[model samples]
Structure formats: C-alpha cells, structure tokens
Target: MSLVSINPATGEKIREYEETSQNEVEVILRRAQNDFLSWRKTDFEHRNNLLYKVAADLRSNAQRYAEVMTEEMGKPIKEGRAEAEKSAWACEYYAENGEEFLASESVETDASKSFVTFQPIGTVLAIMPWNFPFWQVFRFAAPALMAGNVGILKHASNVTGCALAIEKIFRDAGYPEGCFSTLVMGSDRVGELIDHPVVKAVTLTGSTAAGKAVAARAGGALKKTVLELGGSDPYVILEDADLDQAVTACVTGRLINTGQSCIAAKRYIVVESVAKPFEEKLLEVLKGKIMGDPTDESNDIGPMARHDLRDELHDQVKRSVDAGARCLMGGEVPKIKGAFYPVTVLADVTPGMAAYEEEIFGPVASIIAVKDEAEALKAANDTPFGLGGAVFTDDVEKGELIATKVIEVGTCFVNDFVRSDPRLPFGGVKESGYGRELSQFGIREFVNIKTVYIR
Candidate 1:
C-alpha cells in the first residue's frame, strides 16, 4: 500500500509514498524509544540551541515550504507562508521560554527543602491534520521537543509531503536520527501505534471521532493523550457593534484557510436588529472575494483540500437551504476544475439544521438571527463544540465581559477573529476535545511533574 498526495487544485497527482509496514513501524518505535533515553538526558541549553537553529532554518526556507503546502493541500500560498513563519515562531518561543517554564519550583512543605520538577516522559505520537499542516505539527513538536521528549508524526495522508518536510527540518537542524520521525501510514495504523509500548503519550489535532478513537486506545494502555479536535466556533455580532468592523472580522474569520480551520468562525450569531445589515455587508464582501489558483496573491479564497470535502460542504449547504435557511450568497460549487467550493452564506440558520448543528469544514458560513444580546450569547454557547469564539460590540467593556465570562470556549476574542498563539494555551472543551497545547501548560502536558523533598 502507498500513501498518495493529490493536488486539490486542478485535481492533479503530486507524489506517492510507500506506506510503512507494521514491522517497519515497530523498528521506528523501538529506535525512537532508545533515542529518548539519551535525548531526555540532554541539557536544556543544548536543546534550546537546537530549537533556535530549527527556527532559523524554517524562516530561511519559508517560501519553498509554503509552495509545498500550497501544492499538497490547496492552501493559498500567502497563508501557507504565514503558517511556516508561525511554526518558526513556535520553535523560537519554546526555545526562549522552555527552560524557565519547566524549571523546578520550590514549595513550602513539611520537608526542609522541596520542589516540583518537570521531566520528560518519553516518545510521543502526534496525529495531525492537513489544514494548517505545518503550524499544527510545530505547535505540538516545539514544546514536546523542548521539554526533552521525541515526536513521531502520523500526519494526514493527503499532506504526506508536509510530513516528510517536517522530518527533514528537524534532521537538518542537528536533531538526532530518532528525535523526530514521520510514519507514512494510514489511519488504520493509529490504534496499533497508540498500543505500542514505546509510545508514552499521544496528541491529536483532527476530528472528534478520531480523537475519541485515539483516546480510547491510549487510555487502555494507561497513557496520556492531548486532543485538539473539531469546532463549530461562533462569532456574535451585537446590535451596538461597529457594523463595518464586525462584517470585516466575520468575513475574514469565516474565509481563513478557505474556511477549513477548526477554530474559524463557522457560525455568525447576530442580534436581529443588525442581522439584515450584517448579511448585506457580508454578502457584498463574499461576492468580491477572488477564488482562483492558490499561488495567485490576488486570490482571497482557494480550493478546498479535497473534492469529497468540497462536496460534503455543498451537501451541508443544500440541507440548510432545504430546512428554510435563506441562501444569502454563493451556495453552488464552482463549474471550473479543482476541488473549489464557492463562498456560501446561509441566513436564518436555526437549531437541528445541518449548517447550525455540524462543523462545515469548508468555505460556508451559517448566520443565525436572535432577538437580543442575551439570545445571541445563548445561541453562541448552544453547540456541542467549545473551541474558540468571538463577540463583536462597540462597547468594549460589554464585549470583554461576554468574551471573558459569558462565551463558553477554549479561547475567546472581542471584536476580532479567534486564533491560536504560541504564547497562549490553546485547546477546547466539550466534544471539541480536552487538554491544552502551546505555552507553559502545553509543554507540561507530556512531562512528569515529580516532587523532590529533603528529609
């Protein structure tokens, strides 16, 4: 069996990689485990220096990496470039702050001297997705590697090239042979990998179902797992919001990554007084967006990562419209080639509809109208997902209060789009998945928090 890479744009074949056999996987696992023994013993200074080198390498080759991402999974070249730079930032962030974050902390206990120390566990398996391929892997790898753990990536098959490129990045940066590796295999092998004795923990950035499967496998093995899963994030626009600003933010949020992001604003919940105007303004912007070749800088949207995904998104739109939601904008698939999906907007979206209930992982936005701010907030938290959300209002204090206290999501923003940052802990609640990634909290996720005491 082989893992094939297909260009979502133009529907062309890019490359194929031979799948790693069970025997080969076992060899890789054993080697990673053996290397971890030495890797975990390396001093923080040594690790930090290596990470710094990796960051420099990423920036120097950002364009080429971006091209690979564009070709492999249909990301706009510009966005792909940003993803690479963001990935480099993660490496640099961890390098600069990792040692301090993981330092032993003194505690006043009965013992004369006592402290809590963060220590690496062992080999960790990262099962990542194709959307923002580079950023997702680095976000997990940077902190895990900096904290003295090795990583083995099982990236989405469609982005196999990206998986290999990442392996090369670490290798060229002076990391040991087993420090980081990419396993070329399908999802069927995930359970086996999780069951492997060498794998001490698992981290996944994918669907809720995938997370559940991995969590089950790792749980039975008594291993830790951190899952960053699906999201149907909402962006609430209150009547008092700056209409132009709210429309811009919602459009940008919904269209980012061609709306493939787990945290992208999938649902726009607007107060009824402003719903019509918001819809009108949002429609004008959506109609103006240029969708074309990902390499083109002028294009605002690109093809989705796969044709099947594009079809699925279209089906969701069809269902929503059938359920009485108004199609305010593009709702049909483009007639041209490639896995291209047009920017679609469905207004009057309500509970139990496909657009309102499920994560539409494409360039489709569902707008729901509510009577007031209280109803808007209620609608925002009415989903099974709690990944990230934003609330827009002219009143900064009200927006801040709603974002900080009212919205139920892992991360919330006021008058802006939701995003993940290296400086902040990123994760989700409810079925969106548990545990955190990035920052001090993330680095400690795969570490042993051991307490030392003196008699």
Candidate 2:
C-alpha cells in the first residue's frame, strides 16, 4: 500500500509517497554502511560542530517545519512549533555533551594498563512514532549520530513528510549523505531491514506490539535493540498534598499533547480525605479549556491526531462509564467539525473497568478514589504499563517514601508532574518496554564498550 499523509482536521490528502523498492532499500543500506566508515572516523569536534549546524537550521525554519507537521498530523500549530524547537534543543544538547559522555574511562585491573572505550556500532534502524513526530526521531538521531553511529529512520506512515524534512535538515547541515536517511516504507519491511548485515542495531519508539516484533527480529539476528513503548501513568494525590496544585497539574498533565503522550497521566488516584475536593477542582479547571482548530492561538485543546483515534477514545470512555464509572463532566464527543473528543473526566473508576486497565490516548482522565495512601499506591501499581507515575505531597519525606514503594515504573516524580528532559535518562519498565533514551546513558545505548588491557 502507498504511504499517504492525510490531514486529520479536514480529512484532506496532503501528500502521497511510494514505498521504497527492495532494491532501493538494499542500496540505501550499503551506502549507509560505506558512509559509517568515514563518518565514524571523523573527530568528535567536527561531528559536534555539524550537529550544532543542524540545530541552527531547524530553528531557522521552525515555522515552516511546524506547519508541515500540523498539516500532516493535525497537531496544533503552536505545539508543532514547540516540537521543532525541542528537536533543535536535543541536537544542540547532544552536540555539546556527547564527547565527554562517550570518552573512554580508566578502570583498575590486574593488567598494567586497563581502560574501556566507547565505539560506534555500525548502522542503526530507528522505527519512530507519529506522536511528537520530529522530537521522537531527533532525540534518537542526535545522540546516535554524536556517538558515531549512522541512522536509518523508518518513521510512522502518516508523518512521511516530516521524516523527509528531517533528512533534509541533516544534509543541509553538511553531514555525509548517508549519515541519516528516511525510508519510506510499510511496517512489514522492518524485519528485512533489521536482518540486513549493514544494520547493526535497532531502536523503536512506538506501541508495545510493534516494539516486541522488532526486538524479536533483532534478537534473532543477534543484534541489540532498544524499545520505548506505551504507558498508563498514574497521578497519585495524598491527603497531605497540595490539593490546588495537584488538581491544576492533573488537568495540564492529562491534556498535554491532547493526552496522546505515552507518559500522560491516565489514572488519577486520590486519597479519600481529598478525593472529593480534588474532583471538584479538577472539574472546575477542565470546564474552562477551549477546544477548536489547532491553528488558532487561543485554543487550549485541539482534536486528536486522527478521526479513528478520537472515535476509539470516545468508545473507551463510553465503555468505562457503562462499566459503572461515573462521568463527572464531558463524557460525550464534542460537537465540532474535526476529529474532536471532549475534555472528559470520569470518576468512580474500579479496578475491573476498562479505563482502569487501558491507556486512553486522548483528553480523558479516570479518577479512582482510595480510602488511604496504601490503597492509592496499590491502585497505581495495578497496570501492565509502568512508564511513569507522579506523586503530589507537601511532605518531602512522605512523598519520597511513597515514590520508592511504587515499583515497576522506570521513573517517578515526587511532588511534581512527569516530563521528559534532555538532561535526564528516560525509559520504562515492564510492558512499557526496555532501554533508556536520553541523557548520558541514552547516548551509550547503541555504542560498543570495548575493554582494553595492557600487560
């Protein structure tokens, strides 16, 4: 099937791309392998300088790139612009810190001299997602390139234009031609690419099933893989928490990226003493959010990326409510032209309900009331996904204690909402997938740590 970019806002076809032929794919792999030989040999300073150039290019054309992303994926123009800026930040961050991060280190050994050096693992295949289209790919690209590994991006089908633009950004920055290339193809073709001799490792930021598939293929080939998958992250509120701050943060956290983020707060677990007040404040705040066209600067919430997603989230909400959950406010789909689901808030969520178990990838939040902190923690940990979780409490010690007890998550935020930063390592545990994606640890994910010993 042909890859097509459809505007989810108006259901218009923005562009169409033919899948890369098998022969062309082989040629691309060979060229990438050849480029890696020269590219990897380049000094760190040169690579860092080129990456800085790429960041500059991205910032210079941020508006144009944002518009393309908005048109292709229906993300609000403002958010799209921010996404591009974030990509630039990732590029510059890696450019600035990569050398030190990858520098060899001395270790004590029985031999006279011993050290461990980081080396580039040939070509890497990046199977990225559509949500945060530019940011997702750039985060992987920046660190991998800085670590001396070449990248081949197989981005989401709907964001092909964004993918091509990213490739152009790198080329414009004066990097070698094959240092990074966008492969316009279907999901089925990924296994072939993973098994190709030129491709040394694979990294994916997508659904759990997709991550598992690619990881299995890479494993069979004896190549390393990194998988960043989904989450139903919890927002836990203790009785001693700042009720007002927790409520406001919950609204923003749950609705960020229109609630499409993997780490978006899907479950709200509140201690019984503050549950009623929290729910009241949450409903009050959500009522004022403006939903309309993403291009409008005044709009707070835009449509989901596509109609099918909006419909799916709506159905999930409906099922949750029917399964004995109470709709506190805005449960039905909003009366709008585009793929818009209302900013919904559901309460009285039980463990057996679908919303409690599933990740609602839209502006929907499920509030589960608990009798005490113990029950709150139990409810929070009762999910297959453990990407992230947040705790709000005035007592720092109490918050830290609670955070430590909530096992299975890759990261936890004490008295704060969860967010991804370039300076911190980000990933998830359990079904959320394995492997780190940012910071010093992230840059080393695809590199070879070779140990040397001298007699």
**lDDT per model vs. reference:** 0.93, 0.90
- Say which candidate scores most in lDDT: 1
In Å, residue 9's CA in model 1 sits off its true spot by 0.5
What is candidate 1's TM-score against the reference? 0.99
lDDT of 2 by residue, 40-128 (tens): 99999999999999999888888999888888877778888888888899999999999999999999989999999999998999999
Q: How many backbone clashes does candidate 1 have?
A: 0
lDDT of 1 at 415: 94
Model 1: ten consecutive residues of lowest lDDT:
326-335
For candidate 2, the 10 contiguous residues with the lowest summed lDDT are: 399-408
Cα lDDT for residue 106, candidate 1: 98
Q: State candidate 2's TM-score.
A: 0.98
Model 1: clashing residue pairs? none
